[model samples]
Target: MKPSGGSAPGGLFSRLTGFPAGTGGDGVAALSKRQWTRLTAAHQVRAVVAHRWAVVVLALLGAAGAGAVTLAQTPVYSSTVQLVLTANYPAKDIDQVSRGSNYVLQRINTYATIANNSGVAKAVIDKLGLPYSGEQLMANVTVTTHAGSTAMEISVRDTSAQRASDIANAYGAEFPAFVGKLETPDYVDTAPIRVSVTTPATVPAAPVSPDPVANVALGLLAGLGCGLVLAAVRYARVRTVRDERHATEITGLSLLGAPAVDRAAPLLGADRAATPAAEAFRQIRTNARLRAAGQRLTSIAVVGSVPGDDAAAVAANLALTWARAGDTVVLIDGDFRDPSLPGLFGVPNGTGLADMLSAGTPANHALQQVQPELQLFLLAPGTPMPGSAERLLRTNELTKLMESFRRDGAFVVLLAPPLLANADTLVLLSATDAVAATTRVGFTHSDRLAAALQVLQAIRANVLGIVATRP
Candidate 1:
């Protein structure tokens, strides 16, 4: 439906200010925080999808680095020797045996600490005849004890599996003697505590470190997380319109059409009438008509958000689409600095809009009929007058000419200059009944689109919608 005046209902400003849709009032309303969050999240997802290749490459690189490090490291083997500590005092009754078991459990932690001490490491090194010093041997030894039990485990690691096992076994065999000497008193003949080996250390069949599969998997996961963060940052910083949805969100305008990128030809021919590009133009024409259904949509200014947006081609195709539907369409090259409609229509640009406005030339004399069968006419920019183009467009003659076309029941489509590039576009926009903005996918910046819309809204110009075109 056609929006009241020019402001779109539920537009970007309306949504931000929490005002009632289409009111364009100063009153405040409830904010749509949830809707804004959903839009931001959608944009982030699209950004990540657009940079999927970069994410994949990073993950692969991380995995390769992890695999390289894993393969280059030296493999180490581990062996564990289990020991049980017990009370050596004789127990004749069940109560005394229970008391002896309690004593062993209480002293288990102390024995575990001694197992990992430098003194025990030195004894084990001497017994095994190993080259390592007490400090070096203790570095690789680990002692652990179970809760409510006298069982203890002494584990050792080395480059060689056989050496690891020998070191562990030596620690187990020498620990008992060391503990017995420490527990013995000067007045007693025997010690009150005893240490015994319950399980002998064995050579491990596999290394304990540098697992290739696990390292690569972890690296890949870490890299993927980093890539996602980078993608989100890029999305937030670049601020370019990602797609049709992004363009709509930035401009707060309805989507008229999304024509695919076609570089071979700027104008749609009869042979391509059944193609997607032709259908897209037809859709845009239909949507524009629908938006201005109840209003007098006599003149439509086709403006580009920025240069290189191909607004001229869009305007040309839209005129053709209307002309094909049996409407008298007047296509005008309103861009004075760089007139492209003349070249696109294969016509000479001897005299047109500029002469009619500045030199008092008759509008009928400057108009050229390009396609007589389709009832399509063209008006070139005539002479280059970049300096005074804005002044010429501001004259009353342009408004009168548009009214004259409207009286003749002819639809006028003017290819105005890029909004950001020249000020003449604003003049044309003010003179026209409605505007249809053009944006090139992956080329138009979100800030530029928003700025152009702000300019149109300042003048209260009726905006039909936006047409998205690919490069």
Candidate 2:
């Protein structure tokens, strides 16, 4: 039968065929920039969510560090004194009052500068008998003015609340006298402008610096940002397949199914009929059947994209799934390098595929019946033929054996080694009617999977789809 396209099934097999007919380039390269960005951002968010505990831990560390620094800092108390500049000449009319207000507003900035001057700081330091120098006292002084008003504010910070209040009040008292001396000009008795105290400085009840709450909050924000950046970098640097979508994108094949990892029961045994792993294998069987609707798919080569993908278990379960449905299934351990089906099924490793290809052993004599109730048979990798396994598989005996199984209406499931691990896998795949590629989530590197798919495509092998096993 010839390979033909059909309507895709719903759910796991809904994704379109990724690779084009001739080109082996990126399957998602056709997407627009905006769509690609959204897709990448979605993956990044998922990665961050997967490592949320790390982010939380980093944020807490940052907050604790900020809180510690805040505690170690010296406490500083702040005090402010308010002053107003007014016209010394009595205003006779509304226009005169408006002119006086404008003049004060124009000079308010100058007065604010004078309030923060080193001379004023020196005078305040001398009057209060403080130990600080003029430059040191001026560093802690701040002056501000109100726009369109005749108000100026003088603030001072110090380790002692009383000293801060004294410094601010001293500026309020001495600034007017200093202005008077400068403005009187030795011609008039009083200065043209008068500076009067509007609000006297008060001792602060609490220190303004070393705010623990604000510091911790800022630190938490900064830490959270840093955590997100690190998470994104880690996600970008990761080379393994993240999920089923990632597997599909890499292999450019429809996702057959993902079997949940069950450490307690790795194989789908007869006692574990109702388990999710069994159901997943059954789903994979169904999808494989649907994918090969028009073609003859009696023999399937289960090949892993990379090492440790557990392709042997996938092949065993898949064969068991088909046999449980009343179909005669022959499970062959095609991987002579590392034969696992004998240990998996508790069958003795005797004369099997190796003997059949080299010594021309009868297929029926080499086949072992694993399940008595079900029509399931196992062909163990008989004898350790290390160097000649590839040469044996290249012979036509393998093809004839598969044909004999197909002729008997039995489904042959061959457990082949990883594509990148052994060269015999290509020979096994060529003998089989179809191939079922397996990948382990978070274990199979995407680039390795792509390379395997390219090799399969180069040989024009019939790949059914991908089966992702999640741990």
Candidate 3:
């Protein structure tokens, strides 16, 4: 392993495969067909539960509104006259024209006309003191003939049912005299449409114009239609990345072992309550050992493309893991601007690398032994350090530190600041043997990622690949 100047792909595996593949490609997410199915299924359920109820309520309201609108319209009343055709043969007959049902049928229409004649209607109007004309009366009335029968019925409608019925019966009573005037008079109407005094209209218990129940039903149907429409619209607009297969499509990355929600799995969530930074450390620890083929000891520096990576947390845990394997592992927090390892490990933040570089503090005093196996060296960013910290890796002291780790066969994992945000991490990479890049899932943008990856390629960094972190 050597210092990567501009990120490059080189590992024992890359060499053996003879096809050096970088960790990234042209940023594009191709949605899979199967994922589309899952997305629609979830979306359909959500749409039904959310919008269907609203559609129902809207339907009900629409029905009520329609009923009210109808109620506001003027009412129309109707009356019907049922005339029973009596066999009133006038006892004068003696011809073929007078005996057949056709003759009787032909004569019945005359009765329908006689039933609605101006002479009879006017007399009834005069008797009843009506306001409308006989012609108007006839206009409001319909005389319909029953099929294959010698009978016809007349119905009239107005704003008042009682008045309609009264007019009908009065005009009906006047029909007998008018029939006598007709040359072809045949029969008499014995019955007519009339209202019972006992059932006089009293503003009607229920309205005659609008039916609320039916209106409600119609509204509900309309609401149902609307709900379905909205549901379909939402169904078509769904997107998802709910599983590992989808994650692959979005990132164009290989399926490295995913951390199961269960932290207690073989190499998963060993610390359930741990921060995201700590989780990355565990993943990298597994990746370097199990993912790599050989048993050779490796020193991988953790770097991210942006700050607030909690990279120091990862270094601390990773170093602990190596030390647990009976190797003395030193975790170095190299971020001079915002040192975090000291606070993360509950160690003293005062008198660290910064103190040593500026105040001549001994390395032994600045070094904090967290465990018999693990040691943490918090980088102190004092006045002299911040100004020349980018060149800190160039010092003889840093070279001595690397040599000491090599001699003891102890692993040294340095936590570097993000290269994209600060120059400290990229500069420190020159001193590191390999780079373990941490990329935050769903946070890092593609353009910035392409730039960072390009740097690693330029630096020829021993690209140990990536650690995908979920916070």
Best by TM-score: 2
lDDT of 2 by residue, 8-73 (tens): 211111122344422223542332111223336678888689779878988988898899899999
Query: Which parts of model 1 have CA positions greater than 4 angstroms off?
Result: 1-56, 89-93, 222-239, 358-364, 384-391
Q: Quick one: RMSD of model 1?
A: 7.3
Ordered from best to worst lDDT, the candidate numbers read: 2, 1, 3
Ordered from best to worst TM-score, the candidate numbers read 2, 1, 3
Give each prediction's root-mean-square deviation over alpha carbons. 7.3, 7.5, 11.5
TM-score of 1: 0.82
TM-score of 3: 0.46
What residue pairs clash in candidate 2, if any at all?
none
lDDT of 3 at 243: 39
lDDT (C-alpha) at residue 420 in model 3:
62
Report the Cα lDDT for candidate 3: 0.56
Candidate 1 local Cα displacement, residue 12, angstroms: 24
Candidate 2 wrongly placed segments (more than 4 Å): 1-57, 223-239, 384-387
